[model samples]
Structure formats: C-alpha cells, structure tokens
Target chain A: MSESAAPGIDTAFPLSPEMRAAIIAHARREAPRECCGIIAGRDGAPVRVYPTTNIAEGNRFYEIDPKELADLEFRELPNENAEIVAIYHSHPASPAYPSRTDVELAFWPEAVYLICSLEDPDKPYIRGFTIRDGQIAEVTLPA
Target chain B: MASESTVQVLIPTPLRRFTDGESRVEVSGATVGDALDALEARFPGIDERVRDDSGQIRRFVNLFVNGQNVRDRDGIATPLSPGDELGIIPAMAGGSAA
Candidate 1:
C-alpha cells in the first residue's frame, strides 16, 4: 500500500503569518535570552502562536514550559482546526540553527521546527527545519 | 577554587559579525554567570544582548548548560565543568498584524 493510503497516518504542514508574528514578538520581548513557543495550524497554514516562557528561567538553554505545553495540549483538543505544526525557539546568543540536543529531541517527523536568532535585535534571523529520528532537513518559512 | 572544566560558549549570529564570525568560543568559568561575564568582557558590547536596561537577565532569553536549564539549577550561578557546552537561545516575535 502507498504511504498516503496507509490508515491512522497523519501529515503535518507549514506555518502562517499570525503565528510567525507571535513567535517574533516573543523573541523581541525576551531579547538577549532565548524564547520558545508553539504554533498550531492546518493544511500548511499556521493559525496561532502560543507564547510560552522558556522556564529555563535565566538559563541560556530552552526547555518547553510545562504549564504552557499542558495548556496548549488542552487547547488543542477543543480546537479541531488547530494542531501543532511547528515548535519554535530563538537563539538569543547563537545563530538560527539547531544544536546537538535540538537534533536529538526532535522526534516529530511531520512538524516543522522553527528557530530564530536575536543577535541583531532589530533584524532577527529565522530558519525552519524538519527533524526526525536524528536526521535534519531545512524547511521554508513563510515570507 | 574554580572548577577545571572548559567549555565553548556559543555566540549568536547577530553578534557573530562583531566576533568576526566566531560561532563557538572557548572560555573558562566555574558558573554560567561567570562564563557569560567572560564572554561579554571578551566581546564588549555583547552584554547588552543578554541583559535588560536594568542589568537583569531578560525574560525571553534562556541559557542551557549541558542540556539543563540554568533557572532550575541556580540561574546564573549554575556550575559548569570541563566538556560542558553552553547553548544560548533567544526568544523571537514576528511582525504585527496591525
């Protein structure tokens, strides 16, 4: 059977403008340190950007905020149109790229991983990725 | 005495131009805060990116020592040892709708 013909299979898609703005704003607000959040969308268009605190608190590394993640997951069940399409984070002190842990933790093959670097503050660099089982591939961000 | 561990402090892209494209820099410090201080001292003007106007750590940025968040351990006082890598990631916001 073809991949598309398989049952119980789901495919993830891209991000949208509103979602993009939310991530960017969060980054700017948290300038200097990295900020991270989630994006929900359907059919390749991002619908919402749920901002979450790094909870790394003052740490330079990023771990998804447990409360925020729980809240998002809760919200997802109610909103049929919303599904996690991307997981975004910023590199306040680094580049718009993934580190070793980033690669290792990315288990969602269908979800896009978005990263932004706030080195410039005025002009942050954003990049997208597809990480699956230790493999990494670059994805296109919405212009 | 300070711990004998040495790790590479990764600098962000925007600041890389100032550091001459240096992505990872080697520094020796016992704590995460100390290593950050060393980074700023060497880079100059880089501290502005990590701290707010009042000199406190900005809310959006996160510093990770060995995949663990500094906030859970000791904030800036998180200890570090040799072979530990520091990942500095910033929070980002997109353009406004209005």
Candidate 2:
C-alpha cells in the first residue's frame, strides 16, 4: 500500500560497472526469453545483483520465482542488513524502457525498476525508473 | 477439529505501511484465511491487497507457510500450527517488451 512517493530525481541508483556487466550478461545469457533479478542494497546503494528465474512461461514477460523472492526477502537480505533496492528485467528485443506491462505489474514502489534492453544484441541498454500508483519516473542509474 | 493456533506472519517491506511498520505479527487462526482475516482485523485494508474481490488470493501475491507455498498445499485453506510462519511475498513480475 505504498503511495506515490516513488524515488524521484534525487534518488540515485548507483549500479556498479561490475553489477551492470553482470545484468547485461544475464540478459544475454537468457537470450530470447526474458531474465529477471533483484539488487540487494544497504543504505540506499546497490551491493549485489541476484539473477532470478523468470517463471512467466514465455519470453515476453518475467516473473521472479516466488520461492527465490521469499528466500531473499525473508532470509538472505535481512541477515545482511540489506534489502532489495532495485528490480531488473530484460526486454529481449525492445528498447530500454518500461513497457505497459511492466508499469502495471510493478507492485514494489520502493524498489527502483531497471530494464535491460537487448534490442541490438551487441549493445544492451539499461535504464532505471520508479513506478508507483501507475506513474513512471526515470531515476538516474549512476554508471 | 484443530484449535486456533498462534502463528507469526512475516510482512514484507512493501506491505509494512499497512502493518504500521511491524515486519512480523502474531495472529491466531485455524487456517491461512483465518490468520489473514485476523491480520486485516488489526490492519485495515491490507487484506484487499492480498485477496481479490472474490476473496481469492491474488495471482501475483504468494502466501508461503514456513518456506512452502500454500498453493501447493491447500491454498487459503492450508491449516496452521502453533508458531507457524506465513510469508506474504508479492511476486516480482513484469517485463519491458510488451
């Protein structure tokens, strides 16, 4: 029930080069199908990117396996004093922007949404945003 | 019939607002549905977020009892035991292309 206080212009999605590379690698590895994951963070900065299974049954959508998400949210991240700061998914062949489906299914308003686009195959574009109350606002993904 | 048992429900961060910031709360219920009803009794409007208008568990909202999905068991009818743990996990779903 989080309201419209989605992270705005000030909040920084500091994705490290290594983590960025890992996401791109996951996207490429998953290929035609979409890849999904979450970034664990502490104090508002990203610490790790965990590649999760996309159990959506097709390539056009992604749904992180509930078991994995529960483990992270309930056990893993808590022990580290970290939380999921960002959620990432691959577009496969579309641009690095949130599609209508992404906006609609975004229930976690606190976590920044990162979309990695493999439109060109060779060049994967990654962008970050916050979707809350059906409104989308781009957030800076500090390279 | 099993008596109502007190169990711990884990409230994820996203739903913590409705829980008044309490990550975990103890509720007594014979089944998952009863526990949720008890939760809603304490935190108004939270049940709607987990269940649809027909009172069915939402597609994207997953309820797990001690790491086991309730859907795999008896769904909302899944019985609870004393000190059982229920986890409400909002599925992280969606994709960029269409």
Candidate 3:
C-alpha cells in the first residue's frame, strides 16, 4: 500500500567522532535553516561526511545533490573501504522527526536515517530511525 | 476546534525535556497547524522548536500523524481528529575525519 513497504537496506554503523562533528558543524553553519549530509562507513564506524545541499529552499524538506552523491559513491566504491551507512539532515526550527514525505521516500531500511533538530540551537537534538514498509522504528545510539 | 476522533500527539525524547518527559500527549484540533498551536500553548517554547523566524516548518524535521506523514496530507493544514498519535522526529548528521 505504501512505498516504505518495500524491503529495507542495512545501516548498522556507529557514529564516529569525526562523523558527529561534521553533522554538528553543518547544523551550526546552517543556523536559522536546516543542513543535510551523508555518512559513509563500514564495520560500524562512520568515516566521512558528504555534505549535501538542501534544495527545499524555505520549506521544511530536503533534496540531496545528485552529482555529489554519485561522486561520493563512485569514489568510495573503488577502495571498498566505505559504504553508505547513514543519511542525515537538520531541523532548523523544529524537533527532529521524520515527516510524511520522509516515510514515503524512504527506500533504504538498512541505512540509518539521522535527524538533528535546532529546537535548542545551542544544544541540538539528534536521533536515528529505520523505516520499513512505511513503518518507523527508533534506534538507540551506543553510549 | 478539533473533533473527538483526532489522534494523540507524541513528543520525542529531545522535546520531552521541555514537556516534562511526557512522551505522548493529547490535543484536539481540526488541522495540524491548530494542533501544533494547541501544543505550543500548552507547552511554551514548543512553537519556537518547530518553526523558523518566518513561521514556516523547519527543514530536516518530520511530523507524522497516525503513522502518516503530514507532508503528504497538507503539512500544517493536515486534518486531525481524536485518538490519533503524532510523532515529532528530527534528522541527524556528522562524522570524524580519517
């Protein structure tokens, strides 16, 4: 009945310090609005942050840079060192929550979907989710 | 005014601190915006958490009512009745250099 009904992909990686920093930095840089990016990793450690532009403009939505995503995938594939483990974005003015469009467009159940909310810009809220067949389940971060 | 059949609103962990750790809350409104407004009124600073200076929904945030995304319905204009559950989820990102 829904697109998320499709099978999920794999996203069992942990957030490295570098990966966490990148996301926090992006959120800060895009203050008053939202910022988005991707994480590539393997063996459960995020290694890189591929920053993507949010083409949604003023709306509360996002569209990844196709060219950048493609390039990142291409570059990572050769080394066999990294794979897309997670996709991330910020909530400039609200709490971090998956929207309806997010569920409908979620094609990767295996990849962690991370969100950062600027509800308290000084201390943003971060979360992870796994969407499968339109069902969303929260994932707890490792302490 | 919201009808008696609208859904319940669930505040995520991050926002729960502001809401006294109450994960799920109940509110009534005919539209999503109305429900949010009601939430803001009940919980101060909540409006600021979800909207920008221009009063628009922030990017990277998603609102789901009854397991359905409000974006697909009508965004702030999405209709609401009693007995529904609303979820507020945030987007996450970041990584260290190798």
Candidate 4:
C-alpha cells in the first residue's frame, strides 16, 4: 500500500511520502536551526525515519544526542535487524551540499548523508550525498 | 595477575574495513589499553589509529566505555568488566565560515 526506496530497483534515493513530509516538516519546525536524524533500512533499502534532537549550539550545526544515537545504534536497530542507511539533517541557510564540516565529520562511510536546505523556506529542497574520505558524491532524489 | 577478560568493542564505520566490516568485536584483555593491544594483534592496524604515537587517543577520535568517555575516566588504563561495551566515535563538528 506504500512505496519505499528499493535500492537496486530505484535510480534515486526515495523517501516515502510520509518520510518526505516528516523531514520537510521537521526542517520547517526547526527553521533557523539545524536538525539531525537517521533513516533505518533492511537489506540496503530504507524503511523508517527516526528523527533525533540536535545538541549543537547554533542554527548552522547539528549533533545527534550521544545517548539517542547509542540507543538507536545499539538497541532499536538490532532488534529490528535494520542498519542506519542514511543520516539526515537540515541546513538553515545554506544549500544542501555537504559542507567542509559535514565532510570532515562524516564517519559513516556506508550511510548516505541527506541534507534538507531551508534557504528558500517556501521552495525548500532536499539532496543526498555520500561523504567519504573527505569527498562527496551527490545522490539524486526523485523530484 | 589481572585475568584476561574479553570485552566488546564497537567499531565505527570508517574502521570497519579493518574489522572485516564487523560492527562489534570481542577481544581479551584486563584493561582498555590491553584490549586495544589485543585488537591490534588480531586485526592489525587498529590500536595505532585508536591510540596515537604517544599512545593517546587521537585528537578527533573518542572511545567510550558503556556510554562514557574514557578520557573522563582513566584514559587507556580504564579497567574492563566481563560484558563492557566500548564505543569508538570520531569527533564531529563544524567551523564557522570565515
């Protein structure tokens, strides 16, 4: 009854309607401040979005609460046999490209980094990329 | 003699390649430093990345035991229990654009 990202079957990283709305809404609700969260998946396909609190100091930064991160990575994910396939965040004023800081702080080589840009509040957009070894490859998402 | 105990280490994504893509690994040691040494013995190239030339944790890397930072405790000398979980995370932050 619902559509999701099917890895090999889809050319772009697909966000289910619910997930797409959730992320966009979160970005708007936390407008002028960045938000962080994770998207869990099974078999390399995304299934659910688990939004997390941002612990950083400013609107330009986002940090997942360590305890929250631990809980998802250590407990909930394993219980469902799911892995963190994507790490999503919002950019209050910048474009949705991995910033130098984003690339430097990207530790999960296996997970795609999703950035929602609120630069144009009325016409906000989302983009995904893989940041590994200080390099970024943009991930195309369905328009 | 401190009895050799096996503690679990949670490997971060970047270092998973050295761990054969394993997220968690069990190694035997009486203390955290010993455990890291054991990891190097088993996996090779692990301890060095974790502990630098001076044998201290790298500037941007963090090691947590049971959700607590080792630096807040006793550095590498922190003792391990039978089922302790050690988490490795690289420091993540952003610098204001100039």
Interface RMSD, model 2, angstroms: 1.4
List candidate 2 stretches off by more than 4 Å: A1-10
Docking class of 1: incorrect
Stretches of model 3 off by over 4 angstroms after superposition: A1-13, B1-98
Tell me, by TM-score, which candidate is best. 2
Q: Candidate 1 at A31: error in angstroms? A: 2.3
Residue range A40-72, candidate 3, lDDT tens digits: 765555667788876555546666643345445
Q: What TM-score goes with each of the models?
A: 0.51, 0.95, 0.52, 0.85
TM-score of chain A, all candidates: 0.78, 0.92, 0.81, 0.90
Off by over 4 Å in 4: A1-11, B1-3, B91-98
- Residue B39 local lDDT, model 1: 84
RMSD of each: 15.2, 1.9, 15.2, 4.5
Candidate 2 per-residue C-alpha lDDT over B36-98 given as tens digits, one digit per residue, 9 for 90 to 100: 999999999999999999889999999999999999999999999999999999989987555
i-RMSD of all predictions: 14.2, 1.4, 15.0, 5.7
Classify candidate 4 by CAPRI docking class: acceptable
What TM value does model 4 have? Answer: 0.85
Model 3 lDDT per residue over B1-98, tens place: 54644557766434665687675678777877887888898899977777777766776556777666676778887777667666665433222101
Instruction: Give lDDT tens digits, candidate 1, residues A1-143.
Output: 11111122233334556666777888888866677887766554566777777756453666676445533543342356555667788877667877776775553445677887776777876888766656777776647
Model 4 chain A lowest lDDT segment of ten: A1-10
